[model samples]
Structures are given as C-alpha cells and as structure tokens.
Target: MGDIKPLEIADAVLERYRSLEIKEPDSANWTVIAGIVAEDTRSKQLRVVSVASGCKCPGAIVGKEDILKNNADIIKDSHAEVLARRGFIAAILEDKGLLRSDVRFHMFSSSPPCGDASIYEELDGSLRFTGAKLGDWRRESTEQVLGKTRTKPSRSDSIYRSASLSCTDKMIIWSLLGIQGAFIKTKITLSSLIVAAPHPKLIHSLRAALFRGILDRTHTFANEFCIPPPDLSIHVIANHYSGPAHCTKTKPSHLATAWWLSSYSSVERIVAHTGRLLGARSDSTKHSRLSTNALFELSDSQYQTRSEAKINSQYSILRRRLASRLIADFPADHPRKRRLLAHHFANNDIDESVDMRGALPLAKRSKLSPLPAYLLCSLC
Candidate 1:
C-alpha cells in the first residue's frame, strides 16, 4: 500500500469539526484543535491528543470558517511551534525506545467531558489503518492509490505468514494495544483525581506531570537534571507509567493510567503552545500599542463572544509579565521574596552558569533568588 497521505487525516478531523453543533457539543477550541491535528499529520507524529480547551458559546460554530481564516496566521505559526517542540519531545521518547512513529496521541476533553467515550476510541481506527496497510503490502495485494479493489485468493490465513509484513503489521497492532494499555492506566489516575476534586488546579497538576513525562522521555530524569518539582503523588504516578510496552497486558487499571498520563501531556503541550503564541504576541504588543478598538477589529465575533472570565483565563499566563516586573522591582529587605528568588535560581542549576556580577542591584544579589541571575539579568 502507498503511504497514507497526510491530507486524509486532516480531512477527517476537519470534517469532524464541521459536523459538530456549535452550541450543543462540548466546548473546545475547535479551530486550534483542528490546526494541531493537521500539523501533527504533516509531521507524521502519532497525533496523540489530550484534553483540549473547551468552549461553550451559543453560536460559536457559525463563523468558525471565518474565525479560522482570521487567526490562520497565528494558528499556523503556533502549530509550527508545537510540531517543533514535539520533535524535541519525540527525540527524547525515541532514545528510550518507547516512541512508536505510527502511534499518534489522542486526547479528550469535556465541557462535555462526562459522556465522552474512553480515550481508546480515537486510536482504534488509526491502528486498524496501520494494520490494513501492512497486511495488504505484505500479501503483495496492494494496488495503486486510484485503482479499484479486486478480490484475490489467499493461500495463508495467517497474516504472520510473511516476515516482512509481520513486523510492521504486528508493531502497529501491538503498539495500539499497548496504547490501550496506557490509556487504561491513565484513566484510572484521572478518575481518582476527579473523585478527589475536579478543581482547575487539577489541570495544572496534570500539565506538570506531562512535563515530567517529557523529561523522562528525554532521559532528563535518568541523569540528574533540574526538573521543576512536581507533586510527589503525580511524580510517582508519571514515573511509573512510561506508556505501553508491546508485551504489556491490557489490564483495566493499565488503560486508565496510560490515558491519564497521555491526556495530561496533551493538555500541557497545547497550553504551552498557546502560551508561547500569546507571549510572542504580547511582546509584539509591547513595541506597538494597538488600540483596544483596533485590537477588537482584529478579533472575530467568536472571540468577542468570550466571557470576561474566559478571556482572562486565556490570557492568565500573561500575568507572569507583571510578576516578573514585580520581581525586577522587588525591595532589598524582603527575605521571603528572596527565598522565592532562590528557588528560581536553583532550578537553573541544570543550565549554564549564571553571571551575577552585573552592576544592577538584582544582578549583584543572586544568592537569595530562585531564578538564575542570567534570567533575572535578561528581565532587568
């Protein structure tokens, strides 16, 4: 069989988006979600999904096309960034031999979360497609992309009959099964967390866990590296689950755990991508003051429909700029503040030596700060 084309997956995801009832379905940032889907296809990364940003505007879907068109520039650029970072993440996974090129990640979110089927549903079809491709190719029954199907006599019932085909065939099949195992493992964790408290902080906690997973994949954990301390419980959970191994049994608990870990990774990555885009935009905004009216003009009605709460949530990360400004302007006698600074500096022990001898007050007194003088140095 010929290589499965990227457009096919893009088309499928786009269709799924278009078919949704704008108001009735779950709240998700469909355009951003679709863009991520399309971007992943091009990269040939297993398009594993995690929770998406859910939206709930009454008529948000009506102008989706136009909204997509308007934000296409930023969306495309953001998607590019996500794909780039994913490559770095993928390399980490590859080194550990846990990464499978054919298995994409699928994440689910709910505004709309309760009734959603388990995460296993998304990977099911893709795995089948991978299997079919291998099976046909091995049987030498593959046809031209445009050719009509023809029935052929098969001598062997065993797909494993051919060695060449078997490797790809079994790999795809088993990886998916492995993913199912992972999904189960993830689900269990998520359920327990939900039972405890479905607070917004839960999502943040989940993101940190994902960052840990990425670190693990990069072997950043194997070697001593400055990992932002994650919740001990989450760190324990994430450390134990590296996703599915081929021979792993698909215990119900396993699926729950895998899904939880993978889902957490998806949300974290998407949020990080969004933050990067917003940060880049915020920086540009600093240099050129776009009037609020002018900025409103740039926004689509869809964005306009957003509640102040929603808008604030989206821009919440921007507040770091303010916190950073505060740190830059912090007073000298603030010992507690100084401790906070210390943690930041300590984290950078993973990076290069920070030069603290600059003449600036913040620069000269790095011993009490959390951030490395280098970063604080840049902020100053």
Candidate 2:
C-alpha cells in the first residue's frame, strides 16, 4: 500500500458516511419511526464522544452529498482544529514506528457524544478506535432506565437483553453492542482502545465501569469475535482553558488532573493532548464581557499579592473538606476511597507555612463554601 493523500482520505470518509443506513423493516409508519429512532441513537452515541473529547457540535449529518458539500463550510473551521490535533497525534505515533504506510483511517462524524466525530485506525492488520466521555458524573437512576411510572423496564432494555443471548452467555453485554453492526464493513481486528475524559478522576470512574463490563463474562466475547480485549489507553485532553494565572480558585487543567490520576490505572498509556485554545476576546457580547471582567476581579482580589503559603493553605482546606465528604459517602473498602485518599495526601504535603498576610477574605470563603462536591473533587 502507498501513502494516501488528504483528498483521497476525505473522499473515503464521505463515502463511508453515505453508506450508513437505517437497518429496519420497510413500512410507511415504520420508516418514520425507524428514522427517528436511528437519529436519537446516533445522537446519544455522539454525546458520549462529545462530552469525552470536548468537541461541542459533532456537526450535522444529512444523507445528501450536495447538502453535505454545501454545509461543509459550517464545520470547516472547527474540523480543521480537530484535524490538526489528531494529525499531531498521528505524527507522534508514526515517529514512534507504531503507524505504518498501509494504515487505514475511518472517520465517524455527527455520531458520538464525546465529540461530533471520531477517527479509527487500522494498522499492521489490526483495527482500533478511541473514544471519550467527559463532563460531570451523575449516578444512574432507576427512573432513567425504568421510566416515570417505574412499572417495567424500557423497551430498549428488553431488546438489549435479548441481543445478549445471541452473543454468548459468558460475555458481558455492553450498551454499545447495538451499534456494533455499523462497524461490520470494516472487518478489522481489535488492537487498541483509547478512552479520554476532561479530568483524571472522571477517567478513573469510567475505567472502572468499562472494566466491569469487559470482565463480567469469561472470554466469551473474545472467543466469539476472534478478538481479545484491546490494549486500553486512557487519556486526558485539555480542550478547555483554565482562567488567568492569578485565579487561585480555577480548577487545574484536564492534562494536569490526568497526570495526577495516571498512577492509579494499569492503562498502557495515559496520554495528554492539547486542543485549540479558546480565545478570551472571541465573543464580544455584553454577557461575555461581564463574565470575563468578573473573573478578572475575583482573581485579582483573591490571588494578587497573596503569598504562596496562604493560597496553598486555602486550597488544602477546601480539598480536605471535600475529600472527607466523599470518603464518608463511599464504603470503607470502596475503590473510590483509594483515589480520594491519594488526592488528599498528595495535596497535604504542599508547603504550608502559615501566613495570614493575604488570606482569602472571610466573605469570599463563605461564597466559595457552596461549591459543589463534584467540582471540589476535581480540584483535588
């Protein structure tokens, strides 16, 4: 195989996008219903990627070539930014000799939530894809699965349970199984699976859930599909900007959080990648200006001329309180306890020379008190 040109790759992507179809029975009402169902399913998958990858709009998918071409301008700028970051990753992999000339790429657009798009790689006769799911975590609720009445399980749940029987008794079923048919045409073997999120703590929670799903059954999935569990690579992508330097209260970047959480996982690699920086002056609306000015004022008041010791101490106090709350919520032997403790001890050792010279004002401390536990955990 020879090197592929950009146009050729783009054409291939367009072709693949065009070939996707709603695999439902033909009927007048059924057609409409199926289309709606397919679109919703696709939207949820796209949401997973969007939240994880930090891409806002996964772009819209209309099945017409002319429409896609015409609307190409809408996504062109954002796509360029994403492509640049992905291209950098490709370059790094190639430099390390992990990528080869014959490597095939499959791009999925407007499909998954971690972002509006994703890229899959086929190299050395093996296939793999990366996915991300970011944002604040919420506990799954019974109402979400069972509906408002809670009379019975959702229709989707029944369908999924039925589908699991066709695979294997020993293989644990994954929610994503419903969409596996979309990848059938590629016919590539599994090699690696990279999952990313905005924060390392969130990634840790995600990793635990993923492993539970993967390990629930024996090697039923591997045996049935002729593919073993792929090499898992966890990552943190810094797609959002933390505010100015004097903002002692600003949360650490996703990249830094990922680094802190790296030691807890047995992942093959914990990669940190930077995306296009969001410009402060890009939005000129009054609301945007007001918010920016507010942040500046807050940083100036709380951080300017403040001794490092005072800042560290304030942060430590906040972290310890949050950690204590989380520890109380989880069981003594729970895996999350370990992560919380790791965070607590890690921050506890920071230079704590008591300095009351420039401490955060009591009023400001009271204002910060209502910060959500989830956000505080991220700070740790």
Candidate 3:
C-alpha cells in the first residue's frame, strides 16, 4: 500500500472494469462507470466507486451524446464526486508514504454547478469537502410532508446518504489502518462534512454556537452526521456547490447566509463562491489552481472581510434578479417561498447581542434544539 499511488490504483481498477466487458442494459437508462479499491498498511481494504455516470461502452443501447444532453446535471455532479474521491484517495496514499508529502492535489473546481473540494497541506494535509449534501433535509422533509413518491431518491438525498456512509466507512478504514482505538492514539486530523445551504436562521444559530464552542452540542441533524475534529484549528474549509443546483437552485438567500457564516470564528473560509462563474461549462483548470492557491494563502489569516464584500459586489445584480423572480413567482402566502423572501431580507438584521439565556437549557435536551434559534426567536 505504501508503494502505490492513488492514481495508479484508479487506473488499475478502471482497467479491470474495462476488461470485464460489462455492457449497459438493453434499455436506454442503464450505464457502466469507473471505480477504485486499495489495501492499507495492515492489509485492510477500502473501495470507492465513482458516483460519475457510467461511461457508454460500445454496443450499449444508450448513446453518450444523448445522455450528456439530457442528464447534464447528473454527469456534472458525478464528475465532482469522482474528483473528491480521488482527492481522498490521494490523501490516504500520501499518509501512507505512497506519494510525496509536498505534492498538491486538485480535487474541486473554482466555480459552481460543480461541488467544492479543498485539500489542505498545512492541516496534516487533510482534505475537506464542504456543502457535500446541501438542502437534503429540506428536500426530504418536503417530499415526506407532501406525500410525494418517486422511483428515485432526490440528488440531495443521495449526496447526504453517501456522505454519511463515507464518514462511517472512512472511520472503519482509518481504524483498520491502526489510526484510532478505544483511547485516541492518533488524532484523526482529516475532517469532512456537509454544510447545509445557508438559511438565515440556520446560519445565525450556527454562528452563535460556533463562537461559544458549543457547535457539537447543538445536535442538529447536519451536526450529528458530519462530525468535526475537536481541535477546532484543523482548518474547516467550507466546500460549496457540492451537489446539483437544479434540484435546489442557489438563491440569493443562500449566498447571504454563506456571507454571514464566514464571519463566524469557526468557519475558516469559503471555496467556490460563484461556482458557475468559475467552472460552469468550460474546463476548471485555471479556476482550480487559483482557488487552491487562495485557500492555502488564507489558511493562516483571519476571515477576510474584503472577500465577503467582493462576493457581495460581484453577485449584486444576480441577487437582485433572483429576488425579483422570487417575488413574482411566489405571493406572500406561499409558505416556503415566503420564508425564502424573509431570509433574503433578514440577512443584515441578525441580532448578535441577543442573549442565549433560556436557549441552552432547552437545547441540551436535543428534542427542541433542532429548530434554529432565529426561528424560535421569531415565534417569541
């Protein structure tokens, strides 16, 4: 394992897959895809299947061109997932001395429509995937409440489930590698978690708890599943746009939420702010290089206020357009849309001086803590 590079492993796995002569089903829907597997120092095996849409092998019923046009979003998301997987694999390889410690790996594009990925060499070379499954809880809850049935789970659902399973799987892999034990032997420095899209209420609560060092105690569904390291200095890079936006478009409210979240002491910085502008349709090489450099440069500094200001300035027009569209499409009585409007307008109104007096007692119980404090305050 120490002698093998992750790219080599990926190539070997893909070659084996090619040799299998697997063909898509007679129907136009089925496909074949790439994947990888590796054994650690202790002979413990870990396999990662690319979430990328299956490649069209010759004789497949469906053509690549048709799939590309119809399922563009799926392909884009799968590619991002594959890139993240590769980065994880590279980190594992480097940890095992298979790759040079100084080698930098690029895992995510600079812009949106594609998910964000950042590999930090300083924080024990840990790789972080931000916004991995954004908007999952909302979508799942909506579907359940509406009693909508579908043949497939939503994209957010798939990403959320996959990230959780990946965490559990990685824990197993790390433990098997002799990394963790009953007592913490070596601190698992590498941390990855899905940051939900910034709803104003959610962002405000997180910011408060993060400032107080009680984020882990808040017990939200996202916090429960995407565990972070205790050190708090491990550099939590917020990976944005990790899932398909078509399922849940990046409204202005979401950007405002992210802007506010960045002000928190816990959130180190954001990656892929305007995801589409950086990577939308073209190759993301330049943007990726620039973003990777930007992340590394900001690793030691405090949160940059100018970066937020720049983001606000750049997206001002787009945000206005999104606001206008929302207002036109959803009247005041529309439950979800109206809430979106409220979030858009309330970004600057978050009361930092608001006391957390009675909140801590109820939050400790977990039952009532899942609701954001902003929402509770609004009710009060």
Candidate 4:
C-alpha cells in the first residue's frame, strides 16, 4: 500500500478488460471500464478483485415508477463505476473486512468519470493565446455560473435514468461512506483512485470533480463522517481507445458487464443489455444480483451473517443526516412529508423525487434540501 508503482495496477485492469472475450464490444460500440484492485497485506502485491464496464441502466427502459417502487430486481445504474463497486461488495460480504480498509484497496478507470471531473467548458488551444492551462479551466468555471450539478448525459431518444447521480459524485460518496454498502453496516474506502487518459492540465478540475469538491466543503457534520481522501492520480493507459468522448470510432455501448472474483467459487461475470441479461427469457429469474433490490432482498435472506451487526457506523449516521437535512424541515409524518418533499425537491432538479402521480414535474429553481443518499448523490 506504500507508494504503488501505479501504472501496473492500471495495466492489470486494462489487461483484464482486454482479455474478456464474451460478447466483446467492437469499434462501433464502446463502453466505460472500471475496476477495484486489492493489495495483499503481506506481499504488497496488487490484484484486481472486481471489474465492470457498462453504460445502460435499468431505469432507462422501465418507467420511473417501476424503478422507485422496487417492483422488480433491476440494475439501478449500469455505469461501470457503480456496477464495479457492487461487484466488489461481493468480496466483502463473503469475507467481512477482507478488503474494506485503507490497508488494501485501489480503484482504476479507463476514462475520466463524468460530471465535475470530466466536464471542462474550455476552448481548445486556449493555452496558446490566453496562457491559461487546462487545469485552470475548471477553476475558472466558478465565475461562469457553471457550478450547478449536472446529471449523467444521455442522448438516447428513450428516457434514461436521470434520477441517479453521476459516477464521480457517487465515488466521492463512497470515499466518505465506504463502498462496503449500507446493508453491510461496515465502513471501507479506497486507498487510491486512478483514472485513464493522461491530461496533465486537468489535474485541478479532476480533483475537484473527484473528491476535492466534498473535502473542500465547510459543513457542520461531525468529523467522524470525514475520511482522508484517496490518492488520486492520472495515468496514460495502453490501448484505451474506447470511451464516450475520447473515441469517435466507437459509441458508448448500452450493454454493461459486471465481473467479480469470487472468494469461494469461480469467477463470475454478468453481461447485461438494456438493463437485463443478454438473451435471458422473460420467465427466467436472471436479474443481476448486484442490482439495488437484489442487494437488499438477497442480503437480508442469505448473506446476513457475512455482514457485521454494527448499524451505527459513521456512514449510517451520515446517511440519516443526509435525509435529515431535508426531513428536518417537516415535523409531520412520513407520507405527508414525502408530499412536502416533492415540492422541496421539485425546484432542486432531483430526478429521484416524484409526486403522487409518478411523473416528474418541470419546475423552476428555488431552494434545495439535502435529502441524503439518493439526493446528495445526484446533486453533488
């Protein structure tokens, strides 16, 4: 864990990705790739334990009502970062704290994450004329009034999942709350986070987009909720010709992949298209176990013993506080508060908030209440 040689960690993941020969994506179809590498406590050796590549989400095809209602087991967000984390949790559940602490964990991505990290409203060659470096582009964004949070961009004609936060924001939350997951009732975080594509100019912006934005905040939350930021760096990936932006030959493929190295069983991989397994029959129970619903139901019924019983982890309190930020505004009961929250969230542009009609309202801006978990993830 002490000063990893970096490139090899990223190279291992990239090699793992390139080695996958399933329904591999071609030049016309691209996808984002991300992985979690675990460091051996003794040998200090690095090995990739979990990896995922995807862009589609379940909320894309199904109606918003279906997703929020928990009507079925559907992968909530198929973005590589989220799915990869989901797969990583499988390791934790199998053996608690096996790789949850700073003593051993690293992350890698084939592309810069979307949102604050990936966006730059800068003109090309600006450095040649104005002497502004690429790193200064995001720093200058504050004055342009571009600080508003952005949802994951989707150009598909169909309504995609806009309710969830971008991968960048979620990763920041993970850094704070540990990717061990809520149900696990335990805490674990990344030691380092590395993303592909060498853009030395974007260091400042990438930091702000990754975890610096959260760390730079002045909040009233307890110090226990704060954790040291992961080692963030950039590396020039080999043969990383597939990304949503950097590669024009390949468009981001809707199909997603979730692959995890099982501690007990053989390696498992889930390849999904349009949110469901490829060629899965309608009657077959082929839902991705990593989906939100599956995590709750399956963990409760089966993997309960694998998780520690400590529900009062700093992250648990933080999640409640997040919900409380807005929930505190109303002293009323749950149902009524939800209705009131709809209005509070209406102007906030939170896609997760829905009124009685199960439809999103196009309302103008006003105020924002921090409805933690889903809300904080989306807005941040």
Highest lDDT model number = 4
Query: For residues 1-380, could you state the per-residue lDDT of candidate 4 as single tens digits?
Result: 36576677877876776676546446577677889988876677777878888765543335323334332345556678777888887656554546434357788887666654554423353321111111111233332222223334443221333444456545555655567765565556676777764355655545454443333321222243454544434343433444342466446676777777764443334444345566665456766666554554544554356353223345544644443343232222345444554343333322222221112233322222333342222211
Regarding TM-score, does 2 or 4 come out ahead? 4
Per-residue lDDT for 234-305 in model 2, tens only? 222221222121123333121100000111221111011111122212122221111112222322343346
Per-model TM against the reference: 0.19, 0.22, 0.21, 0.68
Candidate 3 lDDT, 41-85, residue by residue in tens: 344343332212221110100222211111111111122223234
**Model 1: residues with Cα > 4 Å off, grouped in runs:** 15-98, 101-380
Worst 10 residues of 3 by lDDT: 253-262
Q: Which 10-residue window in model 2 sums to the lowest lDDT?
A: 30-39
Task: Please report how far candidate 2 places residue 162 from its true position, in Å.
Answer: 28
Candidate 3: where are CA atoms >4 Å away?
25-36, 40-380
* lDDT at residue 335 of model 4 (Cα atoms): 50
Please report the TM-score between candidate 4 and the true structure.
0.68
The Cα error of candidate 1 at residue 249, in Å, is: 49
* TM-score preference between candidates 3 and 4, better one: 4
lDDT of each: 0.22, 0.21, 0.24, 0.51
Give the per-residue lDDT of model 1 (tens digit) for 304-324: 443321222211222232222
Q: Which number leads on TM-score?
A: 4
